[model samples]
Target: MGVPLLAIVAWSGTGKTTLLQQVIPLLKARGIRTGLIKHTHHRMDIDTPGKDSYLLRKAGADQVIVASDQRWALMCETPDKPLGLTELTARMDHSALDLVLVEGFKDEPVAKIALWRRGVKGEVADLLDGYVIALASDKKLAIDYPLLDINHPLSVADFIENWLRTGQ
Candidate 1:
C-alpha cells in the first residue's frame, strides 16, 4: 500500500488511544486496512510470568516471537536507539496495508495529530513542536487547521481522512 502512515499523539489523559479506537474502524469500513504500533514507557506484562513465553524472555534473548492458533506477539529489546522519526517509519510494514496508525513515537518521522485536551498541562502539547497537523480538545479554540471537539470524534476522524485523501 502506498498510503502514508499517520500518528495520534497526546499526553497521558488526552485520549489518543480512544480516538484511534473510534477512527480506525471507520477507516476500515471504507476499506482501509490498518495496523497499530503502541509505545509503553513503563514496564508492561504480556506473558504470564510462569508461562513458556515468559521463561524465554527471562533467558535474555533480545527478541521473542510467540505464535499460536489465532494470534502472535513479538517482544524486542529495543532500546532508546530510535533511528529518528523518518527512519522508524521505514522499519515498519508499509507494503500490505493502507495505513499504520502508530501511537507514541512523537519524536519520529511521520506527521501527527496532537490531542490537546483542555486543563491538561501545556507542557505535554509543548513537546510536540510543529508535528501537530491538527489539535483536538473538548473546548473551542481558534487553531490554524481546524478546531475540533474532543467529544465529537467524527470531525477529528474526518479531518484525518480529508488530510490523506487530498494528499495534504
Candidate 2:
C-alpha cells in the first residue's frame, strides 16, 4: 500500500493555503515526493478559451491533457460525483506519491491537522477526533493533540516527514 494521506482542514481564514505554501516546498527540500489533492466547495476554472486543453474538452472530450516543456494540466469534466477519500485516491496513482496533503474534506477517514488561529478558535463540540490530530496555531490551546507552530513550517513539514517515514 502507498503511504497514508491526511487532510488539513480548518476555517476559511485559518491560513490553510498559506501553511501549505510554506510546508510543501520544505517537504520537497527534504526529498519527500508529495502529491496534493484539493477539495473546493465552490466551482473553479483552470482552463481558458482557445487553450489547447480547453478546446479539446469543448469538443466533447471527457478529459483533456496538455503538457509542455515545463508543466502539464489535466481537466476531467463529468457529471459523475465521487464519494470520500477512497474513491478519490482510486483515480490517482498512489505509487508515485509518498503522501497526499489534501486541503479539504474535513470528515474523511484520513487523519487531519486542524488549523486554528489563537483568537479564532471555534466551538469545540464538533471539532475533535477524525478532525484534529494536531493543531497549528499562534498560541497553544487546551487541545489534547500535539501542538505545532504554524509559523514554523519546517517543523510542520518535519512532522509530516516523520509521520510518513514512520507510523507516528
Candidate 3:
C-alpha cells in the first residue's frame, strides 16, 4: 500500500509545528512509523557559504549530497521551478513509513486538519475550505466538522488513528 499522507494546516502562529512535535512521539508510541514534509515560502540554504559543498553548488552543480556517520542530506538547486507536493512526496523513502504528516502546503490536494485559534489573523471561513477533514481549535465554534482540542495531543492522535483505520 502507498504511504498515507495527511496535512496539519493553519495560519501563522497557530501551533502547527508544536502540535506535530507532540503528535509524532505519540504516534511512535503507538508503533506508527511517521514521515514528515514541511513547506516554506522563504528562501533557505542548508549549506553554509565558503564551505566546500556550498562552493561546489555555487560553481553550478545541480545536486550536492553530504554524508556522515549520523546523517546525510541532499541539496538540489532549483532556480526555475519550485517542487510541488507530489514531486516532493515522490522523493521520500516510503517503504519504512506508515504515514507522512505534511506541515504546510495548505493549498495541496490532500487530507488535512486545520488548526484554528481565536483572534489569529485569518478568516475562519476561508481557512476551513477544501480538504479539511477536521478542525483542532483553542475555542469551540459553531461548525459541523469534527472538532478536536488543540491542547490535547493524545485525543488528536486517536482521531488520526481512527481516520487511518477507517479511511474516513
Candidate 4:
C-alpha cells in the first residue's frame, strides 16, 4: 500500500500554495510528517547552469544525485511524457511520511480538496467532482461534502487530522 495522500487542487491564483504554507506548519505541530508533490506546467530546472550536477546532466547523464549534510536531491531526465500521480508517488520515500499532500494534478483520480475564491477566473464552474471529498472556499455554499473556510488554515488542518485518524 501507498502512503495516505490528499490533493489540494484549484485554478491558478487561487492560493493553493499559500494555504499549504500555513497548513503544513500546523500539521507539523501535530506531528504529521507531510510530503508534497507539486505539479507545474513550465519547463523548469532546479540546478544552477554552471554547477557540476547541471553540467553533467546537460552532458547526457540520465540521472544525477547531489548530497550534502543537510539534504540530498536526485535529478533525472524524463524525456517522455509527464509521469502520472502513481508513478510520481512511487519515487517518494513513503515510509518517512505520514501523509502526502499534492498541489495541482487537478485531473488526477485521487482524493482531493477543491479550493475556490469568489473573484478568481473560472469561479462559476462546479468543482464537486467524484474525487473531491471536501470543498474549501472563501464564501459558503450548499454542498454535500464538508465545506471548509479557505481563510482558516487551522480548520483545514483539523479536518485533515481527523481524516488521518478515522479515514472519514
Winning candidate number (lDDT): 4
lDDT of 3 by residue, 1-168 (tens): 568889999999899999999999999999889999998878899899999999999999999999999988889888899888888888889988889999988988899999989888997777776699999998989897899999999889999999988976
Candidate 3 residue spans exceeding 4 A from truth:
none
Q: How much does each candidate deviate from the true structure in C-alpha RMSD? A: 2.6, 2.1, 1.2, 1.1
lDDT value, residue 137 of candidate 2: 74
lDDT of 3 at 97: 88
The TM-score measured for candidate 2 stands at 0.87
TM-scores, one per candidate: 0.83, 0.87, 0.95, 0.96
lDDT tens readout by residue for model 4, 93-155: 988999999999888888999999998888624566899988999988888889999999999
Candidates arranged by lDDT, highest first: 4, 3, 2, 1
For model 1, residues 82-119, the per-residue Cα lDDT tens digits are 34545555666677677777888777657777777767
Model 2 CA deviation exceeding 4 Å by range:
119-121
- Ranking of predictions according to TM-score: 4, 3, 2, 1
Q: Which scores greater on lDDT, model 2 or model 3?
A: 3
lDDT head-to-head 1 vs 4, winner: 4
Candidate 4 lDDT trough over 10 residues, lowest sum: 120-129
> Which regions in candidate 1 have their CA more than 4 angstroms from the true location?
1-3, 79-91, 123-128
